[model samples]
Target chain A: MFAIEANGQKIEAKKGETILQTLTRAGINVPTICHMEGLLPSGTCRMCVVEVEGFGGLVPSCSHPVAEGMKIRTNTPEVMQTRKTIIDLLLSNHPDDCLYCARNGNCDLAKLAADNGVRDRTFHGERTHRPKDISSPAIIRDPDKCILCGKCVRMCEEIQGVSAIDFVNRGSKAYVGTAFNEGLNVSSCISCGQCILVCPTAALSEHKYIDEVLQALADPEMMVVVQHAPAVSVSIAEEFGFKPGTDFDGKMVAALRRVGFDRVFDTSFAADLTIMEEGSELVHRVQNNGPLPMFTSCSPGWVKFVEQFYPEFLPNVSTCKSPQQMMGAVIKSFFAEKENLDPKKIVSVSIMPCTAKKFECGRPEMGRDFVPDVDFVLTTRELAELFRITGVNPAAIEPEPPDNPFGERSSAGKLFGASGGVMEAAIRSAYFLLTGEELKEYKIQDLRGMKGSKELRVKIGDLEVGAAVVSSLGQARKLMDEIKAGRSDIHFIEVMTCPGGCINGGGQPIGADQEAIKARMNALYQIDRDDRLRVSHKNEWVQRLYTEFLGKPLGHKSHELLHTHYEKREVLL
Target chain B: MPTVKSVETILKEHPNAGRDHLIPILQEVQESEGFLSQESITKVGRALNLPSSKIFGVATFFNMFRFQPKGKYHVMVCRGTACHVKGSGKSLDMVTKTLKIQPGETSRDKLFSLEIVACMGACGLAPVVNINGQFYAKISPMKLQRIIEECREKEQTHANA
Candidate 1:
C-alpha cells in the first residue's frame, strides 16, 4: 500500500487499485454514472473526474490507477463544474417527460443532475426522436431517454453473454439497438432483463401489466387470483423504504388482499410442487439410465436460453414448468374447480421477481383452450407500484397468512430465491425419494451463497448423486460447453438466468447494490433456519393435493399441468 | 471481372478465425457480395462466434460498408470545403430531386445511386461529381440535369436497339 493525499487528507492506496477503488475504500464519495460494480470501467461518462496534482485536466478516477505521492482532489470547484456540465449536456437532449416516465422518481440521471446542481438544461441541440421499441413482451427500449452510458449494452453482452443489443451506427447517430435495428423479439434476447437492472435511465424498463391487473380487479365478473414468487417477498420490502431482505411475506399478502385480489397464494407452495416433480424425474433418470445431468427448467430465461442457443441440451432440461407457471395452472384448474367458478372468469395473476416470467406466461404452450393459465404477470417493481397507487402500505398493514390450499409452503421452498437454493432444496428431498430416508443434515453447506457455479456430491444408500448449480447465462454457457465435451459427473443442474437467482432478477428493485442481493439471499437462508417445516417432501398440502387430485408425482395429470416441452427457437443471431 | 465467392466458401477459408478477424472477414464478404446481406452477416457471426449485433455495430461504425447494392450509375458527389464553397450543395439538391433518392441510397429503377463523399483530393476542380469513374469538374444544377438526361437517353436508345 502507498500513501496518497486525497482532498487534503492522507490515505492509503492499495497496489494496482484504481483511484476510485482506493477512495471508495477510504469512505470517500465519488459520483459515477457509467461505473458498474464488478464490471470493467468504461470511463465514458466522465462523471468521476478528479483533479490530479500534475494533470493538465481532470482524469477519470474509475479507470486511472493511483500512484505513490499523488495528490487528488475529488470535489474541487473545477471538477464539480465539469461534472455538472456533463449532466447539463446529457439533459439538453433528454426528454422533458420525466413525470410520465416509468422511472420517474427512481432515475439515476435525474438524481445525478439534481446532485450536481444542474437545475436547468444549459446546452441546446436538436433532439433525436427515436420511437419506443415496445416489441418485447418483457422489456421496452426507449432510445430517446438513453444517455448512451452503454451500461445496458455492457450488461447484456459482457455479463449475460447475450449481445442482443449493441451500439449501432456511429457518433451522434449511434443508439443501442438489436441486429438490423429490428425488434428485440426477433433478436437473441432471452428476456432476462439483466439489462434493465443496469440501465440508469428510463431507456430500459419492464413492460408494465399493472393496468391490466387493476382493470381485472375492478371487473365484477372476474375473480383475480395472485401468487407472489419466493424471491419477491424478501426483496419487495426495499421498495417500501424498508431495509433490504426484510421479509414482508405476510404484509404483502395483506396488501394483495387490499389491492382486490380474491385469493393470495405463495409461489413457494408451487416451488415445493416443483421439488416433488423435479426430484422424482431426477431419480427416474438415475435409475432408468435416462438422460444424465438433468437441467432445471424453473428459470424461464434459462429455458429460453437453452431453446435459442443450446438446443442440443433441450432433452437434458427437466420438463417441469416454473413455480409461477405451476401455480397459475393449479389456480386456473384446481382452484377454479374447488371454488365452483368458471375458469374463463378467473384472472390468474402472479407477482414474480422476473421479467422473463412475463414472457413465460405468454408462451402458447403455457395455456390451454385459448385461455392462458396466467392472464397477467407483475414484476416485483410493478407490484410495489400497484401497492403505492392503491394507497396500501405493506409495512403499515397487519401481517396475515395467505389463503388456504396453495398457500402453505416449506422453508426449502422459500429457499428457491437464492442462487444455490434450488440445488440444496432438491438434494434435501431427492435423498428421501431414493433411499426413503432424510439426510442427517438438511442444509447443504457446499451448495449455498452467491457463487456463479457450485457442485456437490451426495451418497444416497449406494448411489452417489453429483449435482451442479449455476446462475447467470454466462456461467451456464461454460458448464454447457463442459457437458457438450462429454464430462459426465453431474446428475442434476439448476440454472437461473439472473446472477444470484430470482432475488437479483431483472425485475427486482432498481439501484440495489451487491449488499442488497446478499442480504436478500441471507434472508431466505434465515427463514429456512427459523421455520419448522424445512423439507419440500414433508409439505402436507402437497401430499394431500397428490392424493386428492393428481395421482402422484410425474403422473398423467401432473404431466398435463406441471410439465411442458421446449422446441429449438430460430433467432436472428 | 473476378468470379464472386459464396459466403460459405469465404467462411471456409478462415477456418480458425476468431473475433479479431471480424473486420477482415466482413470486408472480404462485402467485396464478393457488393453489399452485406443479412444472411452473410449472420454467417460471419456464426464463424467468428460473435453476435450479429456486434458485427452490425462495427460495420455501421465505418462508413466504408453499405447494406444495399450500388445502382448501375454510381454517383459520387464531393462535399469537401472547396466543393461546398463552389455551390456543390445546390448540385446535390438537384441530383437528389432528379433521382428521387437521398444520399447513400439507390433509386427504385436501380439506375442511379447517390453517395456524399468528403473529398476525392480534387480540390483544384472546386465542385466535382464522379459517375462510373469519370469526373466532372465545376458541376452545376443544369450540368447535373443534362448529365442525368444523357444517361437516361442512352439507356432508352440501347433498349430500342
Candidate 2:
C-alpha cells in the first residue's frame, strides 16, 4: 500500500490500482458512466475526470494509475466544471423525453447530472433523430437517446461475446448498429437483453408487453392467467425498493390477483414439470445409446445460442420446453379444460426474470393452437411497474397462495432460478431413478455459486455420471469446445445464457452488482433448504399429473406438450 | 493492373486469426472487391470467429472502406476549410439532390458515385471536385452535373460501339 491524499485526506492506496479503484475502496462517490469493473477503461465518457496535484490537466481517474504521496482532488472547481461541461454536451444532444423513457428516474446519466447540479442543457446543436429499433422480439433500441457511453457496446462484446451490436460510423455521427444497419432480428442477437442492463440511458430496454397484458385483463371475454418465474420471486423484490434477497413469492401471487388475473400460478410447478421431462430424457439417452451429454434447454437465450452457432448440438439438447412455455401450454390446455373455458379465450401472461422469455413464448413451435403458447411475457421490472401504478404493494398486501394444481412446486423447481440449480435438481432426481434411493443430503455444493463454469462427478450404481454447469453463452462456448475436443468425461451439462442464471437475467431489476446477484442466489438456496419438498419426483401433484394425464415422464402426451425440437438458423437472424 | 486475391483465398491464409485480424482482413477485402459486400463480410466473420456486426463496425470505423459498390467514376467533392469557404457545400448538396442520392452512394446508371471528403491537401484549387483521379478545379454544381452527363454519354457511346 502507498499513501495518497484524496480530497485532502490521507489514505493508503493499493499497489497497481487506479485512482478510481482507490477512491471507490475508500467509499468516495465519484460519478462514472463508462467505467465497468471487469472491462478495460476506455475513458471515452470523460465523466470521472479529476484534478491531480502535479498534472496540468484533469485526469481520468478510471485509467490513471495511483502514485505514492499523490494528491488527487476529485471535486475541485476545475474537475466539476469539466464534468458539468461533458454532462451539458451529452444532455444537449439527448432526446429530452425523460418522462416517456423506460429508464426515466433510474437512469445513470440523469442521476449523475443531478448529483453534479446540471439543471438545464447549456449547449444545443443538431441532434441525430435515428429511428427506434424494435425488430427483436425481446429488446427495443432507441438510437436517438444513446449518449455513446459505449457501456452497452462493451458489455455486449466483452462479456456476452455475442457482438450483435457495435459502434458504427465515426465521431459525432457514431452510433451502435448491427451489420449493414439492419434490424436486430436480422443480426446474431440472442435476445439476452444483457445490453439493456448496462445501458445508462433509455437507449436499450426489454420490449414492454404491459399494455397488451392490461388490455387482456380488462376484457371480460378473456380469462387472464398470470404466472411468475422462480427467479422473479427472489429478484423482483429489488425493483419494489425491497432488499435484494427478499422472497416475495406469496406477495407476488397476491399482487397478480390484484392486477386482475383470474388465476395466478407459479412457474415453479412448470419448472418441476421441465425437470421430470428433461431428467427422464437424459436417462433414456444414456440407456438407449442416444445422444450423450444432453444439454439443458430451459434458458431461451442459451437455446437460441445453440441454434445459431452450434447447430450440431441440437440433437444433444433436451427437447423439453422451458418452464414459462410449459406453464403456458398447461394453463391453456389442462387448466382451460378444468375450468370449462375455451383455450382461445384464456390469455396467458408470464412474468419472468428474463428478456429471452419474451422471444421464447412467440417461437413458432411454442403453442398447440395457431396463437402463441403464452400471449404476453412481461419482465420482472415490467411487473414491478404494474404493481407500482396499480398501488399493489407487496409489503402492504396480505400474502396469498397461487392457484392450485399448477401452483404447488417442489423446492427443486425454485432452485431453477440460479445457475447450476437445474443440474443440482436433476442430479437429485436422476440418482433416485437410477439407484432407487435418495442421496440422503440434497445440497450439491459443487454445482452452486456464481462461477461461470463448474464440473462435478457422481456415481449411480457403479455408473459414473459426469455433470457440468455453465452460465453465460461465452462460458457455454468454452465448455462446448472442451467437450468437442475429446473431453468426453462430461455426460450432462446445464447452460444458462445470462451470467449467474435467472437471478441476474437481462430483464431483472437494474443496478444489480455481483453482491446483489450472490444474495439472490443464496436466497434461492435458502428456500430450497427450508422447504420439505426438495425433489421434483416427491411432488404429489406432479405425480398425480403424470398418472392422470401424461402417464409417465417422456410419454406420448408429455412429448406433445412438454417437448419440442430446434432447427439450425439459416442466417442466425 | 495488379493481381487481386479473392476474399476466401485471403481468409485461408489467416487460418487461426481471431477478432484482432478483422481490420487487416477487411482492408484486403475492400482492396480486392472495392467495397465490403454483405456476403463477403459474413464469410470473413466466420473465418475470424467474430460476428458480422462486429466486422461491420470495424469496416465502417475507417472512412476508406465503402459499404456499397462504387460506380466506374468516383466523384469526390472536397469539404475542407478552404473548399467550404469557397462554397463547396452547395456543390455537394446540388450533386446529391440531382442524383437523388446521399454521400457514399452510386447513381442508378452506375456512371458516377458521390462522396464528400474532408480534404485532399489541395487548397490552391479551392472548391475542388475530383472524378476518377482527375481534379476539376473551381468547379460549380452545374459543371459537376455536366461532367456526370458527359460520363453517361461516353458509356452510352461505348455500349453502341
Candidate 3:
C-alpha cells in the first residue's frame, strides 16, 4: 500500500486499485452511476470525477488508477458543480414522470439528484421520444427514460452472457436496443431480469400483474390463490423496513389473506414435490443407463438458456416442471377437485423471486385443455407494492400458517432458495432411495454458500454418486463446454440462472448488496437447520399426496402433472 | 470486374479470426454486398463468436456502414461549411421533395438514394453534389432537379431498350 492525500486526509491506497475503490475502502462517499462492482469500469458517466493535484481536468475516480503522493479532492466546489451538471444534463433528456414510474421511490437517478441538491432543471435539450418495448411477458424496456449508462447492457452481456440488448447508434442519437431494434420477445433474452436488477433508472422493470391480480381478487366468480416462492419470504422483509434476511413467511401469508386471496400456499411445498420427482428420475436414469450428467430444470431462465444456446443438451435436462408450475398445476387440478370448485374459476397466481417464472408459467406444455395452469405471476417487488397498495403491513400483522394440502414443506424444500441448495436436498433423499438409510449429515457442506460452481461426491451403499451445482448462466456455459469436451465424472448437475440463486434473483429487491444476498442465503440455511422435516420423502403431505392422488413418483399420473419437455427455440441475437 | 464473394465464403476466409477482426470482416462483407444485411450480420456474429447486438452496435457507431441496399443512382450532397454557406440546404430540400425520400433512404423505384455527407473537400466548388462518382460543382436546386430527372429518363430509356 502507498499513501495518497484525499480531501485533506492521508489514506493508504492499494497499488493496482482504482481511486474509487480506495475511496470506497476508506469509507469516503464518491457518487457513481455506471460503475458496477465486479464489472470493468466503462467510465461513461462522469459522476465520480475528482480534482487531482496535477491533472489538467477532473479525473474519473472510478477508472483512474491510484498513484502514490497524489492529492485528490473529491468534494471540491468545482467537482460538486461538475457532478451536478452531469445530473442536470441527464435529467434534461429524462422523462419527468417519476410519480407514475414503477421505480418511483427506488430510483438511483432521483436519489442522486436529491443528494446533489439539484432543485431545478438547469439545462434544456430535446428529450428522447422512443416508444416503450412491452412485447415480452416478463420485462419492459422504456427507452425514453434510459440515460445510456449501459449498466443494463453490461449486466445482460458481461454477467449473464446473454447479449440480448446493446448500445445502438452513436453519440446523442444512441440508445440501448435489441438486434434491429426489434421486440425483446423475438430476441435472445431469456427474461432473467438481471438487466432490470442493475438498471439505475426506470428504464427496465418487470411487467406487472398487480392490477390483474386485484381484479381477480375483487371478482366473486374468481377464486384467487397465491403461492410465494421460498426466497421471497426471506428477501421481502427488506422492503418493509425489517432486516434483509428476516423471514416473514407467516406474516406474508397473513397479509395475502388480508389482500383478499382465497388461499395462500407455499411454493416450497411444490419444491418438495419437485425433489421427489427429480431425485427418482436421477436414480432411474443412473440404474437404467439413461442420460448421464442430467441438468436441473427448476430455473426457467436456465431452461430457456439451454433451449436457445444448447439445444443438443435438451434431452440431458430433467423433465420435472419448476416448483412454481408444479404448485400451479396441483392447485388448478387436485386442489380445485378437493374443494369442489371449478378449475376455470380458479386464478392460480404465483409470487416468485424470478422474472423468468413469468415466462415459464406461460409455456404451452405447462398446462392442459386451453386454460393455463398458472394465471399470473408477480415478482417479490410487486408483492411488496401490492401490500403497500392495500395498506397491509406484513411486519405489523400477526403471523399465521399457510392453507392446508399444499402448505407443509420440508426444510430441504426451503433450502431451494440458495445457490447449491437443490443438489444438497437431492443428495439427502437420493441416498435414502438407493440405500434405505439417511446420510450421516443432512447438510452437504460442499453444496452450500454462493460459489458460482460447486462439486461433491456422495457414497450411497457401494455406489458413489457425483453431483455438481452451478448458478449464473455464464458459469453454466463453461461447465457445459467441459461436459461437451467429454468430462464424464458428474452424474447430476444443478443450474440456477441468477448469480446466487433465487435469493439474489432478477426480481428480488433492486438495491440489495452482496452482504444482503449472503444474509438471505444464511437465513435459508438457518431455517433448514431449525426445522425437523429435513428431507422431501419425509414430508407427510408429499407422501399423503402420492397415496391419495398421484399413486407414486414417476407414475403415469405424476408424469402427466409434474413432468414436461423442452424443445429447441429460435431467437434473434 | 471482380467476383463478389458470399457472406459464408468471406467468413470462411477468416476461419481463425477473433474480435479484433470484426471491422475488417464487416468492411469486406459490405464492399461485396453494397450494404450489411441482417443475414450477413448474423453470420458475421457467429463467425466471430460475438453476439448480434454487439456486432450491430459496433457496426452502427461508424458512419460508413449502411443497413439498406444502395439504389442505382446513389446521390451524395456535401453539407460542409463552404457548401452550407452557399445554400446547399435548399439543394438538399429540392432533392428530398423531387425524390420523396429523406437522407439515408432509397427511392421507391430503386433508382435514387440520398446521403448528406459532412465534407467532400471541394470548397473551391461550393455547394457540390455527387451522383454515381460524378461530382457537380456550384449546384443549385434547379440543377439538382434536372440531374435527378436526367437519371430517371436514362433509367426509362435503358428499360425500354
Candidate 4:
C-alpha cells in the first residue's frame, strides 16, 4: 500500500485500487451514474472527475489508478464547477417530464442536479423528440429521456448476454435501440428487465400496471385478491426506510390490506404446492428413466431464455408452473368455488420482485375457464408506491397474518427467494418421497449463498441424485454448453435469471449494493431456520390441500392447476 | 435476384469465427446478395453462434449496409461542403422528382437507386454525380435529366440486343 493525501488527510491506498475506490472506502461520497460494481468502468459519466495535485487535467477517479504520494482533491471548486457544467449540459438536452416520468424522484440525473444546487437550466438546447417505446410486454424504452449513459446497453449485453438493444447510428445521432429499430418483441429480448434496474434515468422501466390494478380494486363487483412472492417481502421493506433483508412479511400483508385488497395470500404457500408437483415429477422421471437433467421452470426470464437460446432443453425443463401462477390458478378456480364467487370477478394479482412476472401472467396458456389466471403483476416498487398513495406505512401498522387455505407455508417454500432455494426445497421433499425418510440435516449448506454456479450431490437410498444451481443467463449458458457436451452426472438444475435470485431480482429496489443483496438473501435463510416445518412434505396445509382439493402430487388435479408447457420462440423477424 | 449462396457458404470461410466477425460476415453476404436480407442475418447469427440482435446492431450502425436491394443503376450525388455550397441540393431534388424516389431509395421499376454521399473526392468538379462508377462532373439538373435519358436509351439498346 502507498500513502495518499485526500482532502489533506493521509491514508494508505492499495497498489492497484482506483482513486474512486480509495475515496469511497474513506466515506467520501462521489456521485456517479455510469459506474456499476462488477462491470468494467467506462468512465463515460464525468461526474466522478477529480483533481490530482500533479496531474495536468481532471481525471476520472473511477478508472484512474492512484499513484504513490499522490494528492487528490475530490471536492475542489474547479472540479465542482466542471462536474456541475457536465450535468448542466446533460440536463439541458434531457426531457423536462420528470413530474410525469416513471422514475421521477428516483432518477440519478435529477438527484445529481439537486445535490449540486443546479436549479436553473443555464445551458439550454434541443432535446430528442422521440416517442416512448412500449412495444414489449414488460419494459418501456424512452429515447428522449436517455442521458446516453449506456448502462442498459452494458447490462443487457455484458451481464444478461442478451443483445436485444444496443447503440445504433453515430455520435449525437446514436441511441439505444433494437435491430433495424424494430420493436423489442421481435428481437431476442426475454423481458428480464435487468436493464431497467441499472438504467440511471427513466429511459427504461417496467410497463406500468398500476392504473389497471387500481381500477380493478376500486370496482365493487370485482373481488381483487393479491399474492406476495417469496422474495418481495424482504426487498420491499427497503423502499419503506427499512434495512435491506429486513423481513416485513406480516406488516406487508397489513399494508396490502389497507391498500384495499380483498384478500392477501402468500406465494410461498403455493411454492409448497409447486414442490409437491415438481418433486413427484422428478421422482417419476428418475424412476421411468426420463430426461436425466431436469431444469426448474419457476423463473420466467430463465424459461424465456431457454425458449430463445436453448430450445432443445425445453423437454428437460420441469413442467410445473411458478408458485405465483399456481396461486393465481388456485385463486381463480378453487377459491372461486369455495367462496361461490364468479371466476371472472376474481381478479388475481401477484406482488413479485420480478418484471418478467408481468409477461408470465399474461401468457395465453395461463388462462383457464376463459379468464386469465393472474390479472395484474406489480413490482415491489409499484406496491410500495401503492402503500404510499394509501398512506399505509408498514412501520406504523400492526403486523397481520395471511389468509388461510393458502397462507401457511413451510420454510422450504420461503427458501425460493435465494438462488439454490428451489433445488434445496425440491430435494427436501423428493428425498422423502424416494426413501420414506427425511434427510439427517434440514439446511443444505451446499445450495446456499451468492455463488454464480454450484453443484451438489444428495444420495437417496443407492440413487445418487445430482443437482446444479446457476444464476445469470451468461453463467447458465456456460454450464449449458458443458451439459450439451455430455455432463450426465447432473440430474436436476435450477436457474434464476437475476444473479442473486429473486431477493436481488430486477424488480427489486434500484441502486442496491452487494451487501443489500446478501442481507436480503440471508433474511430468507433466517426465516427457513426459524420456521418449525423445514420441508415442504411436512407442511400440513399443503397436505390438507392435496387431500381436500387435489388428490396427490402429479395427479390429475395437480397437473391441471400446477403444470405448464414450453414453446420454441423465433429469434429474429 | 434471389440469394445465390446461403449464409453457410459465406460462414464456411471462417469456421471458428465468433461475434467479433459479425461485420465481416454481413459485408460478405451483402456483397453477394446486393443487400442484407433478414434470412441471411439470422443464419449468420446461427453460424457464428451470436444473437441476431447483435448482428442487426452491427448492420444498422454502419451507413454502407443496405437492408433492401439497390436498383439496376446506382446513382450517388455528392453533398460534400464543396458541392453543398454550390448547387448539389437542387440536383438531388431534380433527380428524386425525375425518378419519383427519395435519397436512400430505389425506383419501382428497379432502374435507379439514389444516395446522398458526403464526398466522392471530385470536389474539383463543384457538383458531381457518380452513376455506376462513371462521374458526371459539373452537372446541372436539366443536364442530369438528359444524362439519365441517355443511360435509359443505352439500357433499351442493350436489352434489345
**Highest-scoring model, DockQ:** 1
DockQ of candidate 3 relative to the true structure: 0.76
DockQ of candidate 1 against the true complex: 0.86
Q: DockQ order of candidates, best first?
A: 1, 3, 2, 4
What is the TM-score of each predicted model, taking all chains together? Answer: 0.97, 0.96, 0.96, 0.93
DockQ of 2: 0.66
lDDT for position A293 in model 2: 88
* Backbone clashes in model 2, listed as residue pairs: none
Evaluation by TM-score, superior candidate among 2 and 4 = 2
Error of 2 at A302 (Å): 0.7
- Model number with the top lDDT: 3
DockQ of 4: 0.50
Candidate 3 chain A: worst-modelled 10 consecutive residues by lDDT: A120-129
On the 0 to 100 scale, the lDDT of residue A199 in model 4 is: 88
> Could you give the candidate ranking by TM-score, starting with the highest?
1, 3, 2, 4
Q: Give the distance in Å from residue A155's predicted Cα in candidate 3 to where it truly belongs.
A: 1.1
What C-alpha lDDT, on a 0 to 100 scale, does residue B104 get in candidate 4?
A: 64
lDDT per residue for candidate 4 within B16-127, as digits (tens), equals: 9977888888888888888887888878877887666677767766777877788988999999999998899999999999999987678888999887888999899979
Candidate 1 lDDT over A438-530, as tens digits, reads 889888888888899998887888988888999998899999999899899988899999999999999999989999999999999999999
